[model samples]
Target: MTQEILRAEGLRKSFPGVQALDGVDLTLRPGEVHVLLGENGAGKSTLIKMLSGAHHPDEGRVLLDGQPVDIRDARTAQRLGIATIYQEFNLVPQLTVAENLALGRPPRRFGFVDTRAMRRQAAELLARVGVDVDPATPIAGLGIARMQMVEIAKALALNARILIMDEPTAVLTTGEVDRLFAIVRQLRDAGVAVVFITHHLEEIAEIGDRVTVLRDGRSVAEVAADTPQNELIRLMVGRPIDQQFPRRPAEVGEALLTVRGLSRRGAFDDVSFEVRAGEVVGVAGLVGAGRTEVARAVFGADRYDSGQVSVRGETLARADVHAAMRAGLGLVPEDRKGQGLVLGDDVAANLGLVTLRRATRAGFVDLRAQRRAAAKVAEQLAIRMTGLDQEVRTLSGGNQQKVVIGKWLVAEAGVLILDEPTRGIDVGAKVEIYQLINALTDSGRAVLMISSDLPEILGMSDRILVMARGRLVGELPAAQATQDAVMELAVTDVEASRVQ
Candidate 1:
């Protein structure tokens, strides 16, 4: 057997009110992809952070090559041939892609930055990742999917012996994910030990060599990569999810949000759709399919040319977010942290964000009512947090997502536009979000959900709208919307006269 590259023994970590990791043990071997599997709040993040030197464990130790080592910081870990790609990006948006790629260790020529060499090196990295981005483009200019690829490339620059990737495929398209998997396989063949973490269980069998399941801050089991997904789900979530989607079809009602001739030039073109009350209208598409653009146009987050957005028979002004909100339209954006909630504030404040305007009288906000409403919503969502005053930035990914949805719920939105609502969320939290969707539709509200997860689109959506190349190619009812059908439409050209 190959010798172990890294080992963790009885790792324990705690916060003010949370024991993040408790007696978690793990072993990694050279040239192996070790999947750190868990549901949200299952201590997976904490364990990885400890190994990456982002957080020090309260108890237990890490061994590298059978020698006890203190991973004091990220830099120390990197120097010791360990690298990590976190869920949250560690990139500078203002910098060019080439500059970001060569951030810390730029090649110098006689005390000057080697600009040409940097671009050349950046091109090679981008090619390795199968991304065709110009090295000169600013990080801010690229979409979230491209940004994620850049993160992977940046980590690859380290050429570390041990790599830790967290939710690396969350933002990628199906083709991009395949390319990433290929790169990972290459790295594994090159004798690099990879620690992979993802909420998507299918990826475990595809890319992982071994699996470590964490549940409630403890490592519950170590199993083979080819273990049945049902068993893996049971191990991580502690129960079988008989119904992954659990979408209860609601009676279709009148249209709540309508978009006609929505065009955003290069981003999206002539997109039109309507989400009706008491229905979950799912927008399914590949990456860059313009689903998000169309949703944003309807929500007035982005201006649309030659389009009309109407809510409850009232035509909304173009590029007016406040107008959309006043029309009872609430949008859960794709980049939740960047657009949804205020990270620096407390839970109560974030939950009250959408309603603060109405709650204010004579320039004085009603703090009492806000707190009461936040408390109710928090409890309703089962958001795990110590208190309402706790910073939203500190909560787990799943809890933070609930806060975003709670903000809209507190506003009593008649129509909710959810963009990738369960992007990085685990199976349990995903079901919770789906349950919330059912609750919304059951209460005579409308939901326009945009997602890349085809299974989710097929399972939850009452009616599916497929987009490709910035156009709505086809629509399917719940009974007829299979994954194959959606993909067929998703890959269809906009100019096609009829569905293939």
Candidate 2:
């Protein structure tokens, strides 16, 4: 029997109105990939935070190699060979790769920083992860996949015996994910214990060795990595979900959003599309294919080189977000935490964001009316929050997303652009979001959905627009669309050349 590397027993954590984690247990063995499976708010975050020293467990103990240890802070965790790579990269964007790798504790010789030694160490670390990025390049210059590699390299810098990766493949392309998995396998072979957390069930069978399912802050079951997807979904959500993407697309109506010659010089070009009322127009593409850029431009978040976005026959002014918002366009961005909601504010404030100015009465905003409006939207979306006064930051990712969508509803937006609507949400929350999409479309609203999730695109979209190298390559109706068809159109010429 293999000895355990790390263990958590009866771990519990709490916040103001929510019991973040009730009692959770996890075990990691050397040279094994231990997967943590859970919904967005199912105590996964709290558990990881406790392990990584970001939070203290209110009850229970963490054991490392048969000895209980108190992980006081991040430094202590690192010292104990525990490295956590969160979904958001922690690298300093302004610094070079080598500088970021040696950020806090650069090599010092006679009290002077040793730049040469730092770069050499960084190169070794990068090579260990099979990443070939130059040490001289700034962190900001690297793409997401490259940055992820750099993060892994940074983790390896600690000579990590236990690696905790949170949604590592969430933003990665297929090829990049393969590369990452290869590195993970190498690490596992080298006798490192890995804790892999992801919302994508498909990856579990491929990458994991053992699984611990967390539901409502409790560790319900520890099963094999090869567990069926439906069973895993059932365990995580504590219910059998009949449909993953329950999209009941409404009857098609007149065009509400029309984009003509939408082009941004380097991001995207020659993009033209229309999202009609009561339909979902899914934009499918690989990373850096410029789908998000086009969405941002359409919402007036960014300026396009030469193009016009029209809402109901009226052309919106260039680079004017207010005009776009007033013209009935609401954009639910991919980075919901950064762009979709103001995290520090309460639920009512975030829900009233789109209608703040309109909800004012004689130089005073209607706080009472705003709360009422937020309460109604929250109830409509079934947002599980204590009250409207609760901070948006404390709510789960799914509830936060509903608040983002609810604000637009409060504003009465006719066209809602959802970018990766169910990105980090669980199966149950995803179904809820899909039903909301149906309701929105049934009420004669237009939805322009952009997603990297191929199955989601196929299942929920009425029409799919495939983008490659910043251009619209092909379009497929739901009747003719499959993952293969979508990929065939979305694959870049570089992939074709490589395949040949």
Candidate 3:
């Protein structure tokens, strides 16, 4: 039997107005991958922070090998063989891989840094994690997958016995995810306890050994990794989710948004499609397949080298974002935090952003009008928050996404463009977003969506458009679109070229 290396008993934490974690207990055994599953505000982050010494539990005893220890700080946690790799990497982008590996503790000889020894050690660590990049390469130049491998290497460098990974595969491609799983398995075989946190339910079966579900600041269920996905979802949300996608049937109307021969040199080429009113058209593709580029071009976020974009039979001027907005087009961007919301601003302010022109009067802002508009949108989206004055950055991932969508709703956009609308949100929140999409389409609004999750594209789209390399390769009705067919069109040059 494997030894239990770390244990938490009755962990409790509280914030200003939230009980972040309440009586949450967890046990980690060496040579096992224990998955921590939860929704956006389910106390997962709070528990992880306590374990990693970022926060102190209000009431709990943490045992390391049967001995109680107080992890006072991050350095103390490191010394106790506990390392955490957060979703947002901590590495300095300006530094080289080797430099980042030896960030705090570089090799020293006679009070001087031993650069050669540091590089050699960094290379060895990278090799252990199966990362095949030069140690001298800058971190900014590497993709998300390679950077994740480097993070693992850094943890190994610290001799971490318990590794905590928070949403490690959130930004990785399918192939990259496979490689990461291989490395994780290798670490497990080598007797390292891995605590993996993710919103993607499918990953539990793929890489987890044991699973723990947290909901509303409490640990609700603990089971083996082989537990059915439906049971896990029930445990996480406290009820069975009948439908993952709440798609509704809508009559397709005349084309509200149309693209013809849209070309962005080196990004996408001759992408032609139409999103009719009262329908959701999903663009499916692999990473770097120009799905986002196509969406950006049509929305006027990015300038296209050539092609025409028309809204309701009227041609739009190229590279004009204001024109697109005036024509009743709205975009819920992919990077929601960075591009969608003003993090420092309050919920009311963010919701009133796109509709500021309408809310303003006599060259002065009308706070009362803005508040009313924001309240209406919040009620429509069912956004849970302390109040409209609460900072958007303080809200959960799902709530932040709602704010992004609510901005467009307040703007009264006729055609909406959603890029990875539910990318980092939880399953429960995803269902809510899908229901919102249904409501939007039912109101005779058009939607053009770009998504990498095959299940999402299959479930929500009225018609699926497949993109490969830099072009629109194939189109299929949602009823006839299977995962296999989408994959074939997304990756195979022969089939894609023939269809194009």
Residue-pair clashes per candidate: 0, 0, 0
Model 3 segments more than 4 A misplaced: 93-102, 106-159, 494-500
Candidate 2 lDDT over 1-500, as tens digits, reads 89998889999998987898898889899999999988888999899989999999999999999999999999999999999998768899899999999988899999999999999999999987777888999998886667888888888788799999988887777777888899899899999999999888899999999999999999999999999999999998888899888889688989999999888888887889899999999999898898888998999999989988899999999999999999999999987887899999999999999999988889999989888888898899999889989999998888989999999988889999999888777778889999999999999999999987788899999999999988888899999999989898888584454468
Q: Poorest 10 consecutive residues of model 1 by lDDT?
A: 491-500
Question: Mind giving the per-residue lDDT tens digits that candidate 1 earns over 400-451?
Answer: 9999999999999999999999988999999999999999999999999999
Task: Give Cα-based local distance difference scores for all models.
Answer: 0.93, 0.90, 0.89
User: What value of lDDT does candidate 3 attain over all alpha carbons?
Assistant: 0.89
Model 1, position 75, has a per-residue lDDT of 86
Note each model's CA RMSD in angstroms: 1.5, 2.5, 2.9
TM-score-wise, the better of 1 and 3 is 1
Model 3 superposed RMSD (Cα): 2.9
Q: lDDT by residue for model 3 over 337-398, one digit each (tens)? A: 86899999999999999988866789999989889989999999999888999899878888
Q: Which residue runs does candidate 1 get wrong by more than 4 Å?
A: 495-500
**Residue clash pairs of candidate 3:** none
